[model samples]
Target chain A: MSADRLIKLELSKLNVHLPERRPSLREALSSARPQVVARDGSTHAFKREELEFLAGLLPEADRDKLQLPILIALEPKLGRGTARISGEAEVKVVSQVLEKEASAGELLIYRPEVAILRKKLPTTTQYLFLW
Target chain B: MAALAVSPTRMELLKLRQRVGLAQRGHDLLKEKMDALVIEFFEVLRRIQEARMKALEQLSVAHRALSMCFAIVGTLETKQASKETRRELQVEISTRHIMGIAVPAVEVREVERNALVRGYGLHMTSSVLDEASREFERALKLLIELAELEGSAFALARELEKTKRRVNALEYILIPRLKEALKFIMMRLDEMERENFSRLKRIKAMLEERG
Candidate 1:
């Protein structure tokens, strides 16, 4: 029973580091100090270099549509290591960065690919658990 | 193999199934965290390498400048200049999270200061001494950056090891054990039902024979 509670607690904490309200790419780029407040109330800052790299990937109009810290969703149903990236702007940027063909609104990447994406966009990408 | 001690009942089975589910979920999320941590750790390490190189080079330069100052103005005078100069440096240490782990983000005040801000007596401050001070100040800034990077790296590494351990326990111990116990209970329940059915048939046959 204690073990059950611990596992449940761990699961609950899996996504708590995620921001309650993620700062938009435009907001982050324009602000003097770009950061988001997590659900746990801790702040996460976006590096200026990462923001600039993200800006280079999209046109000015898409900056607002493109959220900062783009979430790479991991669902058990997707299998152990596969993750998905949704949102049109997010798909565009991820597909381009990974050099994969651009899909419409969603992109599915495997574990190794996810690692590469995280490596390239540390400040701009985060892992989000689903299901 | 580590079957949890429980009766072979439906209630225990239900609870065990739930535990397995929770374990699997925790394992998956922690694995993800581990992967993210690896990326973060490597990034810090790479930055540390660059910072280490720069800082080391600057330190050597500072040492050379100091040696020259020692030769130009006797050793005692150079030592006196260093004593009078401002030596207090405070790092503004805060934290940022990476996959739920709070790694530190340190900011140091402007380390490279002008001669006047260095707080050395102007009359006693020779050009050689100024040169040495300038080099050392630049080296200090680089060193501070290196320290921040190294600190973050160590924190990330510690968290990574912890997450990896949890993932391994779920994968190799808890989940497999729960599944094994679940199988054992299901098999026992099936065998019990079959034995009960056979006994009822035998009793009916005896009754028919007696009639």
Candidate 2:
């Protein structure tokens, strides 16, 4: 029982690095120092160049729709080496970066594609583990 | 693996099943963390390779320029000029978290300065000396960026190792032991139930014989 409790504790601590509130692209671009606070009270900063690149991908009206630190959801049930990218603005920007045809609001990408997306947009992208 | 010490009862079997479920969940989540860390590690490694090459090339170029200055402007005079120049350079260092690991984020302040701002007297230092200074300044900037990339790679690699260890422990040790204990309790309960059934049957036969 004690061992089981410890496992639960470890699971809880897994996502402490995630931000309390994710800022939109517009809000982050307008700020002098663009960053979001994590649940653990640490700050995660966005690079200015990455913000500009993301902004350039979308039009003026879509800036607010795109959120900072676009989450790539990783679920074990999805099978190994697969991840999902959700949100319309996020999918649009990611597809443009990867040179893939933009799908709907969600995109299921394989391992190689994930690597390309990460290499292209390191600061603006984050991995989110879903049980 | 040794099965856990517990009385073989239905209630204990229920608790063991729950424990096995929790262990499996933990193992899966931790394996996912390990996979994510591997990706992060390789990403950092890729950047570090590019940064290292750039920094090394710039450093060699700076060294060549310095050699030229020493040959043309006289070694003693070049040394004197270097001594007179202002060498105070500052870098802003901070932490950026990737997952839960804190990797270094370094921002170098303006390192390249013009001839006048270099603080060495204009007449004493020749154009060759200025060229050397400029090249060295560029090399310094590249080296700082390289350092930041290398630091992140190391941090990521360390975290990857740790997560891998935890995943292995769950997969190889904890889960197997729990399952073994669950199997033991289940088999014991079945045996006890059969014995009770036969004992009640014998008692019923004896009562019928007496009647």
Candidate 3:
């Protein structure tokens, strides 16, 4: 029972770093200090440079559609070293950054590509773990 | 292997299954965290490599400029100018989370100051001194960046190690043990059911023989 309790605690702590509410790109760009508070009550600020870079990649109309701290979902079911980028705007921005083709609303990127993407946009992207 | 001590009952079996499930889930999720941390660690390292190179190069350049200043403007004068120059440079530091681990985010605002702001009087200050001051300022800025990157790399590496240990514990120890206990309980339950079946059959045969 204690082991079960420990596992439950571990599971709960896993996603505490994730933001409570992710701001849209439009909201973040318009604000002077673009930041989001995590579930753990810590503030994470987005670098204006990275935000501007992401802004340039999308059309003005799609700016609102894009979300800050874009989730690169890593699900075990998707296989190791593979991550999924969902949402039309997110997939588009990520694919454009990696110079890969985005099919449908979801994009599957490999480890190398994820590295490159994270490198290019460190503050604007976050890793999301999915069971 | 030594498994957990639990009664070989259906309820205990179900609880064991749940524990195994939780353990497996924890292992997989922690493994994912570990992998992400590795990616983060390498990224920080790659950034550190670039930052270190740039910082070192700037530092050498700054040193060369200082030596030139020392030669042209006289070492004693340059040292006096350095002492007179303002040294109160503030770096804004805050915490940022990368997957539950806090790493420092440092912001150096306006490290490069001009000749007038360098606060040394114009009478004694020469172009050489100003040049040296600017180069050193640049070097300081780069060094600050390098420090931030290095700090992030260390924090990420530590988190990665911790996560890796948890993943291994689950993979190599906890999950396996839970699974072993699971298997033991299922086998025992099956054996008990078989024994009960045989006992019932014998009772029926004996009753029929008496009748």
For candidate 3, write residues B155-190 as lDDT tens digits.
988888887888888899889999889999999999
Q: Candidate 1 or 2, higher DockQ?
A: 2
User: For model 2, how does the per-residue alpha-carbon lDDT over B85-184 read when each residue is reduced to its tens digit?
Assistant: 9878889999889997899999998889989899998787578899999999999999999899889988988888887887888899999999999889
Chain B TM-score against the true chain B, each candidate: 0.91, 0.93, 0.91
Top candidate, metric lDDT: 2
Number of the candidate with higher lDDT, 1 or 2: 2
Candidate 1 lDDT score at position B66: 92
Mind giving the per-residue lDDT tens digits that candidate 1 earns over A1-131? 67677777878888988888877789998999998888888888888999999999998899999987899998878887789999999999999999999888999998888878988898788889888
Give model 3's share of reference contacts. Answer: 0.76
Residue B47 displacement (Å), model 2: 1.2
Clashing pairs in 1: none
What's the candidate order when arranged by decreasing lDDT?
2, 3, 1
Q: Can you tell me which runs of candidate 1 are displaced by over 4 Å? A: A30-32
Q: Give one digit per residue, the lDDT tens place, for model 3 in A48-76.
A: 99989988999999999998799999887
Candidate 2 residue spans exceeding 4 A from truth: A59-61, A99-104, B121-123
User: For residues B32-84, could you state the per-residue lDDT of candidate 1 as single tens digits?
Assistant: 76776786788789889999999999999999999999999889988887788
Separately for all candidates shown, the number of backbone clashes (residues 3 or more apart, or on different chains) is: 0, 0, 0
Q: Candidate 3 has what TM-score? A: 0.90
DockQ (C-alpha based) per candidate is 0.60, 0.74, 0.73
